[model samples]
Structures are given as structure tokens and as C-alpha cells.
Target: MRPSPLLLALPALSTAQQQFPFLDQVKGWFAQASNSISSAIPSAPSPPSVPNPVASGAKVIADAKVQPLTKDNYQDVLKPGAATASPGIEEWMIFVTGGNKTCFGRCERAETAWNESTALLSASRSPPNLGLLDCEAEPVLCNAWAVGPPTIFHFLIPQPLADQSTPATTVRSFGLNRTTVTAPEIASIHLEEKYTQKEPYEGIFHPFDGPLAKAGLAIPVGYAIWGFSLIPSWAFMIGVSFISRSMMSRRMQGGAPAGGAQPAAAPAAGS
Candidate 1:
């Protein structure tokens, strides 16, 4: 016997409900799982390249442009105005006036002696300009004490005396000193010319001497001025107050006995 239509429909509906129980909860869990899977995948990192440590060192060497010292081009990197134009009185007396007039013999000997002496003593010598503590004498000596390149000697004579000038005549003389060094160390030396004119009224005037000549003297002047200027107004006021108080105390101590000091007590009111 076949079931009636309503009973058949009722049974089919019940089966569908039973099969679909907690359908919303299942859909929600499926959505959460899909989100978690999407979040679990990580983004890839950028690719890296190998580092080259020698590149920077090579660049520094390339930038240095090491070269040999020569007469034509030795002053390229030396400090400007390092070599004095006119020799000191002692040097002039030893090498110029006392030496023979021949440019090659006594002059060359004097130069050689001076170079050797300077190279040896420079390590222990102090800078003439700044205080002794300010300089690293050894480093300066090591850096500057090199034999100069071979140079031609030229003596300049005034135009008026050129016709009568002789080789023995004292005039301006110029020569070069040579030096050699290993790779990576470059030494440059220059003779900076400073002209001095002696006027009857003005005495000796060095044309090239500039503000650097006064830098040492100006430091102390500026320091003193700065220290005085920085004194606070309160300090001045306090000084004035101390002086005023001292004056007032002295006046009170020296004043006429406060009300004339009561007549010596009147002999003790009739002894």
C-alpha cells in the first residue's frame, strides 16, 4: 500500500530538515577557515646581492692619485706659504755671507748640511708659531723632511747693476731640493716668496703677511674680552653691595660715641 500524499510530503520535509541541521553554523566555520588559509600565506622577501668590501678601499686609493715628486711639479699638494722667502739672520750668516761665492761648492754643502740637520732635529724641534704642546713634531718631521729635487740656480740682479754685476755679487738666489719616497706617500715642498721693502720711515714691511700673523695675539685678546663681557649684572651688583656695606660699617664704628656716652656715670651718684 502506497502512503498518502500529505504523509509522503511530511516525511520528505522532516528528512530535509534533519539533513540540514546547523547549516548556518557549518557555513560560518567554512568562511572562517577560508579566511585563515588566505591569511596564512606570507609575502616573499626581496632578493639580496653579494657585498664587495674592497670597492671602498680601491676607491680611496684611486682618488689619492699618487705620483712622484719632481722639480716642475712638487708644490701641487704642499701647504701654501710654508717655506720662508728670506732666510733668518743666523742661516744667512752661516750659508750666505760666510760661504764661498761659487753657487755649486759651499752653497751646495751648506744646503746639504742644513737639510740633514733639519731632518734629524725636526723630530725633536717645536713649531715656532704655536706653543710647543700644540704640535706633533715627529709627524711633521716625518712628513716634511725629504730631500728636494735637483734644481737650477738663478741669481737675480737689479736692472741698474746688471751690467756691472759679477758672480760673486750678492743677489737673490733660487734653487731646488729633491726628495724620493715609496708608493702611496706623496711629499710636496714649495718656497713661498715674501717680499719685504725697507722704507726710510716705515722700516721693513712684509707685503704678503696677512691676518694669520696676528691670529695668535688675537686669541688672548678675544678670550679676555669674552670673559669680561660674560660677567653677569648680578656680580657687579654684588661687588657694589659689598663696598657699600664696608663703608657703612666703618662710618658707624667711627661715629661720635652714640649719644655722647652718658657723662662717665657721675662718679657713681655721690661716692
Candidate 2:
């Protein structure tokens, strides 16, 4: 029987495939046109190696209206102006601290308490400003301000008080005694007047250089006791002593045996 061309080509193809493996693949590729044709060949020009951002470099553009957030601009945003400013009117809570082992922690705790209290107070309005001071560092200032650490002094309606010429009677530090002093005693000294020589609270400060300055001018509280009541006491004591002495002398004379005057016998016997 005679062999067909396709059958006769098998040996040559096998030899060619043996000589070149890639040609065998290429021949199969040519013979079979399937979805894998394009996929089988690759290294595909790498899509022109998309340009690197760094190598190409970025461009600089100028904006006429926009400004960079420089410190000056940032400060401008925070800068206080009349329109946006909180009023100078502020109830200040000065948290004074001393130099002690627990002072730092104690002061911090006091500050927190003050903040909470003031926050509560300001719930209906603006809160008072908080201030911290080291009493050890500014003793003179504290003295002048009549402020003691851990002591509370409320300046109620300061605006109205500032308007009045006289001292506001309401302006006073909380009265303290052994019973009232807070535990872990933060302050012991009490001041009722201001001595801020540097910058006195202006019209708000009340010093004792007034008419009542010389209070010790012998001003009597009531009846001037010139040791007069003592005179009556002395007189009564002297009278009592005189009567007692006289009675004692008479009794002694009478009791004497011969010279001593005895009790008189019945007058009838002498008659």
C-alpha cells in the first residue's frame, strides 16, 4: 500500500522537532490558532517603559491668591483681635504652689479641682482664666496680692467693684482657723490687704494708708477703765481686813488672864 503525504512527513517533522524544540513550538503555534497564540509570545516591548516621576521632575506653579502656611500666617490665624478676642474681664484663679516634696502633685491636683469648679461655675457663661504661680518663687508678689496657696478668694463682680472708690467689703479671703484650714495645709498665712508695689491692682487695690491707718491711737472701745474699778475692790478688801483685825485684837485683850478685860459679871452683884 502507498503512504499518504501527511503520513510520509511525520519522520522529517520528528527529525526537525528533535533538532529544534522552539521550532516544534512554532510549528504547533502555526498549526493551531487558539486563544493562547498571543499569550504564548511575550516580553512585549514593556509598554514603552512608562516615564519615571522622579526622572521627569515635577513642575513649580505660582498661585497669586494662596499663601503658604508660614509661621507668620499661622500666627495671624491665632492672633487675637478686638472682634474675636475674649474680654479682659476674667475671674482669675491663681494656683499657688510651695516648695515641698508633694507640692508639685498637690498643686496639680488643686489646679484640676479649680478647673472643674470654675468649669461648673462657667457652665452658664465663660469660664474664668486659670493661673499657676510658685509661691516659693514669688513670695513678695503673693504677699502683695494677699494670696495664700490652697486658699480661695472670690472676687465677685469685679467690674462693679472696680468702679467704686471704696474697698469692696465682699473682697476677702476665706476665713481660716485650725478647723477650716485644708488638709495637707497648703497655706498658713492670711493677707487682707494688697502690697503690690510693682503694679498695684490700680484702683482695685486697697492699702491701709487711709484715715484708719493709725488705729492704735488709744481709741477706747467703751468706758475708759483707768484702774478705777480696782479702787472699790481694794476698799472693800481693806474694810474687811480692818474689821477682822479689830475683832481679833479685842478678843485677844479680853482673853488675857489678868490685864485682859474679861466678860463683865452681872451688874446686880456690883450694886
Runs off by more than 4 Å, candidate 1: 1-21, 47-78, 81-209, 213-271
Error of 2 at 89 (Å): 8.9
> Model 2 — which ten-residue stretch has the worst lDDT?
58-67
Residue pairs clashing, model 2: none
lDDT of 1 by residue, 1-271 (tens): 9879998799887787789888768879999999999899986878888645544443343234222232223232122322432222111101121123122232333334333322222233331111010012111211121111122111121122336332221222223322332111111111212112211111111101223112433233334544554589999999999999999999988875876685565566657
Question: How many angstroms is residue 121 displaced in model 2 relative to the true structure, after the best TM-score fit?
Answer: 3.5
Top candidate (lDDT):
2
Relative to the true structure, candidate 1 has a C-alpha RMSD (angstroms) of 21.8
lDDT of 1 at 6: 97
> Which residue pairs in candidate 1 collide?
147-178, 147-179, 148-177, 148-178, 148-179, 149-177, 149-178
TM-score of each: 0.20, 0.27
Model 2, stretches more than 4 Å misplaced?
Answer: 1-92, 101-106, 157-169, 175-271
Query: In lDDT terms, how accurate is model 2?
Result: 0.40
